[model samples]
Target: MPRMLDVSNDVRAEIGDEEADRLLAGDNAPGAYDCTSCRTPGNTEQELTSTVLFVGQETAVLAFAHATCVPSQVVPVSEDQLRGAVRSITGEDTAPSYAPPVPAAAHAAAPHFPAPAAPPAYPAPAPSPASPATASHTSAPSSHAPVPQQAVLGVTSGVVLVGREACPALVVEPTAPIVRPGSPGHGDEFLQLLSEQGFAPVVDLSRPPAPNPGWSVLLAMGRLHAVLMPAPGGGRPVAWWQAHSPMPLSEGWRGAVGRTRKVLIYAAAAGTIGTQPREDQLRAALDRAAARGALVGASMPLAGT
Candidate 1:
């Protein structure tokens, strides 16, 4: 005789009709399912059976029973959650039907920062250095305008604010680090952010000296660029930029900036640009930079600016 198991609503939610049928048919001897209530397993000893009775086009009653064990009350789950369960059973890529609630402690720990303010008005271009009167007199083009200087802060030992003015970017204490990569907390936050941004970051196993820790950006400008690290044997260190194409920076300025710039841009883009250059205008400036071929290590095709 097959073993009978009692499953809660939560377990039933996780193990859809297909898997439940398989389990009742003796396909999975040792398996688990999750539902709103809790996780359930099919490891008990007794004859098992399952049946799906439809209530309507969108609703159904799933029943499971053991030959010797009494069945519990059935529970209702949303159609979307049921679909997700089916995907889970079929081994397909589907978002989970449920997410654990956020802890209040986490909300209290990190206070959310507000958005950034607008940038200052465009400043007048500086005068060019005078050429010797004795040298050949040639007319310089008046159409050329000086590129606005943008200050970028670099964070090595700690966080540095970038842009024309300093702003609250990220808190990075070299002395008291809470979680590093691969840690439970770190992986959770990383995966959450990645999913939100629709990006899949690849881990680089290359040596430390390699440019930008082997980090590459897929810019919206229809190009790929590598983020270079600070130079070795350095004097007045600077990060290097190489373009995969001559695409406009405005189209994908996010991929051009270093880690600090990327973070700031993301913050601003997420309606959090602080009281300096407004987020929209700052993005515009970045776009202009891309248009002028300022992005480093980019050599891909340029698209809409």
Candidate 2:
């Protein structure tokens, strides 16, 4: 059967003008599909769309996007990154990559940041009755100290249902399991760290915490770059977590952030959540966090690229 598609000059150059013409005439293009970049409904038969190519080491996938979301250009990404994007779109567990690697310099030049200065010190440990006079100096919590090595937060986006209503959600997973800064081989205390900073534990998604201003999600070049948190010592924003390769967020997500001026951010201390999960799995995680009162909800303004 003929396919309906909009072939950009760049794509045409790769696929050929004859094929491009055929696609325009619904001869070589696929019918309607989700825009790879924006995750919105797009049709080659109705509006101009870009044919995006994803190339990996041994596999490739052809994806579609709105011309506005991504101009006619080739995007070279890692195989894992490409798979993540596909999982977000298809609501599936696995996807193969197609775009070839871009210049090494392009990937290497992406911004990098050291972890924020140790959060305000944790409360001092309880004083020992036997050492009442030395308590002030001796009772300070050993856990308040900073870790020798820094950790990174890996941010992924997905949808969570609240009573059958799908809500745009951002999941934060730390590169290393988060434990108290000075507590090696200890239990994860990541959620506790956040709670100390005023991210009220989420007891229910239906009832989110009041909006907290000054925090925002930063996007650059129409991709997920970082989640900004208020500076430790009171200055400009600091990246709580950043991506080595910017991840593309769906258009619906962008719109949701703009319209709601809020986002549901959930964090797990020991492990991370996949972009794609069975509905039951998602709900189970939600129930677990709600049970522990560890989920965090905040109002984050949208900052676009």
Candidate 3:
């Protein structure tokens, strides 16, 4: 519809050049529709979008999504699934791999956190007119661990200075080697795993890391809650790393998050960074890790205020 949309070659081939051209001309497209991936409303006129065609044994349904969430493509569905999708009130399908555009509860004043299942929303705490705060948090209350192996993940919250800017940051390290699941080898795959999930090697502290789409940090009640990752098969997001109990954030760090609405998370293998009690010390450790290509990071958008 003369809207900014991406119709992949595969999708075009399946939908046919004539029908695809009709969609491109806006005759077969809607001005606004709910995103098939994140279930949020997107207007083709306002933002870049993708046209997803869901085909089944004997029928097909077209879906829309923000381009940032997923690229235009054809998703195969079962006949019963396609029929159920047509009967569904939302006209949405469940299996497309996608990232969210913006979380539904993203506008809360302070923070928003989601559980592994259904997450409850929380109101932001009252803001105090105090100076920006900084703190390093390691130990906390618990219910979950980062992995199923014998390892302790230490998460520290601190500020990383890039030139004159005090950027909010989180440091993750394990107390033991992290072995890959189902692998017989004992070699650590910590960075390898994170890299596979979209974290890139941090080359320079002077520049902020690129934002990793479909990945974000969840904070609630003014505290660190969990790091949310895309769902395994792509529906609601799930926690990639969660605190047993939410970790505390200082006024400064919290303020920094609220101001920028993004968190810079840096990770390294165990012993590469430990007992970084001060912000300066933490920054130094990060620099050292980056020097050796041991650091991986992403500037993730906050799911809440």
Q: Write the per-residue lDDT of candidate 3 for residues 69-121, one digit (tens) a residue.
A: 66686654334434444543232433232221211111212112232321111
Off by over 4 Å in 3: 1-149
Steric clashes per prediction:
42, 7, 5
In model 2, where do residues sit more than 4 Å from their true spots?
A: 1-112, 118-154, 163-165, 182-185, 271-280
Model 3 local distance difference test score: 0.62
lDDT of 2 by residue, 86-192 (tens): 55444453232222222222222212233553332212222112211110111121233454334444454655666555556676655444665556555567777
TM-score of each: 0.18, 0.49, 0.54
- The model with the greatest lDDT is 3
List the candidates ranked by TM-score, beginning with the highest.
3, 2, 1
CA lDDT, every model vs. true structure: 0.25, 0.51, 0.62
The whole-model C-alpha lDDT of candidate 1 against the native structure comes to 0.25
By how many angstroms RMSD does model 1 differ from the true structure? 23.5
* Candidate 2, RMSD to the unseen true structure: 13.4
lDDT of 1 by residue, 208-243 (tens): 111222222222111122122223343211112222
lDDT of 2: 0.51
Report the lDDT of model 1 for residue 190: 19
